[model samples]
Target: MFPGPTGVTTLKSWPESAARLIAVAAGRETADLVVRNGQWVNVHSREVIAGTDIAIADGRIAYCGDDASAMIGENTRVIDAEGRYLVPGLCDAHMHVESGMLTVSEFVRAVLPHGTTSMFVDPHEIANVLGLDGVRLMHDEAVDQPINVFVQMPSCAPSAPGLETTGEELGPDDVEAAMGWPNIIGLGEMMNFPGVASGDPKMLGEIAATQNAGKVVGGHYASPDLGSPFHAYVAGGPADDHEGTREEDAVARVRQGMRAMLRLGSAWYDVKSQITAVTEKGLDPSNFILCTDDCHSGTLVNDGHMDRVVRHAIECGCEPLVAIQMATINTARHFGLERELGSITPGRRADIVITSDLATLPIEMVIARGVVAAEDGQVRVERRAFDYPATARDTVRLGRELVSVDFDIHAPEGADTVRVNVIGVVENQAPTKALTKDLPVRNGLVRSDPTQDICQIALVERHRASGSVTNGFVSGFGYKGACAIASTVAHDSHHMIVVGTSKENMAEAANRLAEVGGGVCVFKDGKEIALVELPIAGLMSDEPAELVAAKAARMVEAMGECGCELNNAYMQHSLLALVVIPELRISDLGIVDVRRFELVDLIVGN
Candidate 1:
């Protein structure tokens, strides 16, 4: 049941709840709460109307106009806004709760004060580690929250065919079964663009299942080339895409009837470039949406959540009202939640944000479902924490303790100089560049060249504990010291990724995580410097957001101390194993040439 008095959470129950809503709107019944004397940011008319009052009953908006005196009763809770702008609560169109390193409830507790009332989360990261059971655990926790947390059934568990191997694989039957869930909004982003273009049966079957169930199909076409492959993938029935990084990418998605989601996360600053389609090119802004595809605990607790994205969009020359619409009504309309919780209209949920200014968007008070949930960066209401089962914890299982020899990159039979394909990291973006470097072999093994910022990266199989380690070289971390950074939060496959300048330190970092369940660790000079223990599915921490944020901040500091200065380098580190994205990536199987969608040899004879 919904937290509201009418006890209606789904559209199926709206028929029985309509009588009370209609009665309060007509002034025949008393409202439960009333907000007087505020300016309404009406997204329906795309205008800011002054002198507005909202009458709320049974946790739904009954009336919103200049006068609501007739609906006020003796028991109604009256809140005087004092002429603040009553804006609709923000909505994150796309995100992953595991990215925040917090569970669903803690994520809600963290973002509620930032005026985000709704989130469309894709749990594909955890799904790769625990399969359908993981999705069910997340879905059950999401539906119990005070805010709206819609779950998207993960479309691709391995994310790409023949590129990476995951612990659990999901098929079309899994997609069809998740459709019957109460909170499953749609299928998650179909990251296998190559499979979609080539008419792969499994990929097409999953998309058709979502479509047949009348649910949205999310897309992730990361390629910049908008060629026939892009057209073929679009023709395969995906509705919305968030992988656009350029203005043309946004324009192309909208031109093809897909919503172009502009994202501004901790590391991915894609909004400034893509939002130019609306600000400068003057394309239709209605088809544009705003989101944070991935964010860490530090960004959520320190900078802001949706508020940071909206403010950055405004700084990128978007009008404040237009940016707010992208975050609120546009996102709600895209997910078919416009009538439920997007606006301050009659029949929508009573979710309002009181702000002193439109340009800065200072959140003063947050009203979610007619209850004052948060005010001034703190939650006023209490939310219970979810206790994860022990089976979900202690997921790190390495059959044997790792050693420096496991990370040795053996040169070909008689080669002295080896030409290697390196995964080059781009700062503040998701894409990577494939670089080649020729280095001399030492003792018949290819060694890392720290002077060229080339470090060794290995993907250790953590799920099966086969003790398999695939090693490769990566650039752009700028590490100059004896250090290693290891994480079990690798995207899509959720394997253990360790990047280090020294193989000894890499072995030390990996063993530390295996000993302490699962976590992110930084080892320097054969000593552990910083660590953030996840211990839950090897992905998220069950601790409070504040404690996790503190630990994450130290991890960032440790990366800096090790001579890596990229912003949110841990996010870039975790995605190195994601084989769906372009250029190059590493997996437990081997090094993958993502552009060719095949496994490639790490070293070429020179």
Candidate 2:
């Protein structure tokens, strides 16, 4: 998600940065920053040059070579790199900060220590829910950061119009307007693969606007087919794609003149499968890029972000130097920012990562435009608080209090068993299976089928509620006891998603989440057990990242107590209403068959 590079401060270029580094060397300047001696991993030429000296002046790279003793000023604060490998700062080619469930500032605080100096972010997450105003909110926040954070206006609002209903929808008009913004690098992912393949007028219009403005257009071809549909979509004008999960997918994208962004996100593990094209197939590495498509806050803190992706590429047999290229220079080239901050060239930003080892990538220190932003795996910069508008904050609009009756699915008169469609949640991925099971009826209400691991799932229309409730079934939570989990952080729309082994618990859980404004809540044995309050957009917490993660972990533990055991149960619950995924999904309207891209009655005709 990128517009112009405003608000978000650009780490001054090496030309300017070099001046500061030179001043530092000449004693005429006590430079803003200086790294004494660090091994330089020059990704541009795929070489691990060692014992390199880097100089910074006024937030830009002034001098970068074997030795900079001549550039050290009397007052220059020098850091002893101790022969660590100095690599260009990592960059995420395409990502959504909201997927981490953290505000832009919080996300920055979490990733800065991991050596991510720049991100080409698509704020479509907010755009879908809050429109252009939401995109501006995130854009302004990124502009205030210490590193490079660029925004891309969302090109697809409902992602797949008519197939889904988001709280707000963006059109080509919004795209044209965003092109004028300083930080807007381009249009966000063009997710409507079908629309592109068919040459849909609206999709074409958005692409035309982006092209007219000379910005890169993102692509998302989620379907596995690499046939005519894929070809048609590729020819439709998207410049890059990250949804590929196979070697062939990678090869095809590169051959077609698109950058293949390999991602290893918190839940989406795609890099390992696709990197084989470069490692074993002898494909050119320049066309390949690295990104974390989605990462929750815990993963950001405990694991890493772009750094994690680089390490994973190494594990997948890519040379460490090539891996760094994918994260830095390759990403920069894809976004048309090759001369800016991608490499350790003379004119680039002073964004470099000092590492002791090249293969393992032990980030010893991180420099952003000559400033010491992180040291020894710790963030050195302070996160600024964005003034969130009250209207944009706590947007859980549940029109009425929920009751057990709202969770009820009536059986046809005298029906012994009712056939219910269930959404099968695949762990670590966003795809769901359209499953059906016969459920027993009691007191005129159909019951949840725990034996099949099927729990009752419902979507509550929190945006203007309208007393609308769409009830469906979801599997994979493995709930065995009287526990129900509810969350207001449903994908895209951020409605309330409730899933439970029991209707009573489901009612309690869903209602409690609504009462809490927004957040994920788990209920076990009737009483409210744990809650993760997300007051920001009913999807993020204003509290510190650790605090939100701790609360989130407690919610997961509560789910475990209720006999629900799944990897990252919160992710599973959050995706229940994601219609773009597949098989089956629930909306404020009713059960939707995503594979068909159409809504259907809950009870399929027998």
- For residues 357-381, could you state the per-residue lDDT of candidate 2 as single tens digits? 7778877778876677888877787
Highest TM-score among the candidates is held by which one? 1
Model 1 Cα lDDT, one tens digit per residue, 1-606:
375312334222345558987898899988888999999999988899988999987677889999989898999889998899999999999999999999998898889899999899999988999999999999998987777899999999989867777889999999999999999999999999999999999999999999889989999999988999899999998888999889999999999999999999989999999999999999999999999999999999999999989999999999999999999999899888878988999888888999999889988899888788899888976765677898788678889999999999888878778899999999999989988998778899998898788999999999988999989999999987799999999998999999999899999999999998888999999999999999989999989999999999999999999999899999999999989888899998888888888888887533
TM per model?
Answer: 0.98, 0.94
Candidate 1 to truth, TM: 0.98
Off by over 4 Å in 1: 4-13
lDDT over C-alpha atoms for residue 34 of model 1? 94
Candidate 2's TM-score: 0.94
| Model 2: worst 10 consecutive residues (lDDT sum) | 1-10
Q: After superposition, how far is residue 147 of candidate 1 from its true place, in Å?
A: 0.3
